[model samples]
Target: METVRPVETWLTDMDGVLVHEEDAIPGASDFIEALKASGKKFLVLTNNSIFTPRDLRARLLGSGIDVPEESIWTSALATADFLADQRPGGTAYVVGEAGMTTALHEIGYVMTERDPDYVVLGETRTYSFEAITKAIRLIEAGSRFIATNPDPSGPSPQGTLPATGSVAALISTATGRQPYYIGKPNPLMMRSALNRLEAHSETTVMIGDRMDTDIISGLEAGIRTVLVTTGSTRPDMIDTFPYRPTRVVDSVADLVELARAGSGEM
Candidate 1:
């Protein structure tokens, strides 16, 4: 029998695993605290490119979770990292909020509309027709197309709202170009986070609510995956997916003990 390596690192999705909308899930704070006490590497991951890590940190704090600013990883950051590696000091025509723009700017990327190197799309509550049109024209004009994530819809107090993926689809229909997505299920996001933690997949576990995104990405990145039922994916929906998580539980509350055990705190 193969001996399973003990988990040393954690990558958890932000929305379903930690918070839902503006509310933090029960025991989310305890789980984070346990991880910090464990002195293990960890990051709170989110595909929402609307907010920077600082903004996210504050929001999480508002929800009673005390994650450090550096411990949060957003899809915008991953996209910026990818772009910096692909073309150092490149220019882009951006269609995103401050999170996306700030990330690119930090990577020495200049945002412009005149013959840019890439047309970068990210999550934005105010996705304008003008900005998307510009992106379409730029892509048609030989600029590379890239998006932060492929989530078609995002949560709202009212109902589902169109997200980056939905807008990308519109652009693809108009320009015949499929934007390269760099978020969950892409594996690039996972690899980037792992690199940030300097952690190996064999000793890392990804905790997420969505099997399609979190579980798939973790599997592709060669890490253990845990599915929680507090978010998009429920227990009954587990068998619908051909892939399976290493484990499944009711919510992060249930994993607080495992988190403690992983660090020998139990």
Candidate 2:
């Protein structure tokens, strides 16, 4: 096997890479410990904007993972950071949970429903038709559309549920406007994460389960990418994509050795 270069920084997806539903995938805890012991900067990235990092940390702990709150990044934070950079102290009409709202507030953004500067959409368990209607009208009235992520659906115990991208599409169809998605697949999110880590893309590695979102974004951001087949993707599906991840593994367990190697424990 060819020697893999040690990465100084790591960006990993949360859903499939770390946990599946409420259960921690095998080796997840060890991988996190390895990264921490290596003294490398790492962030757990997620497209779900329904919960805050604190909430996510609690959830991960319940599943046997011990990641710190500061080490988790979400689409909500990325969206807020993007907005703050584009228009500081701007007002927005937000349709999301406390995670999205809190992030915007911390960045000095005001939340309003009447004639706001922008209509920010994100993940919500109970998406209100009335609110989506309001978003359409707001966009028609000249508010720019911005969505936290472009994921059409999200995984659940029962099944899949409509997510931010589906809601964004409804509003777009109603108002003839497309939302600027700020999560994975958009290199802006990766750049924002890199900035947060104070890390260079050349020496960073992105580990994710989905190729379309995680792998493609890392490639575009000039970082090494690893695709784990323990989540939404299957090994049989790898050949379908035109682009490929730098490495493919059966699960996160397979990376534990590499992670230890990166930490010079081999």
RMSD of 1: 1.4
- Say which candidate scores most in TM-score: 1
Best by lDDT: 1
Per-residue error (Å), model 1, residue 170: 0.2
TM-score of model 1 (CA atoms): 0.98
Per-residue lDDT tens digits for candidate 1, residues 101-120, read: 99999999999999999999
- Local lDDT at 31 for model 2: 92
lDDT of each: 0.93, 0.91
The window of 10 residues in a row where model 2 has the poorest summed lDDT is 257-266
Q: Estimate each model's TM-score.
A: 0.98, 0.96
Q: Which stretches of candidate 1 lie over 4 Å from their true place?
A: 264-266
lDDT of 2 by residue, 41-120 (tens): 99999999999999999999999999999999999999999999999999999889999999999999999987898999
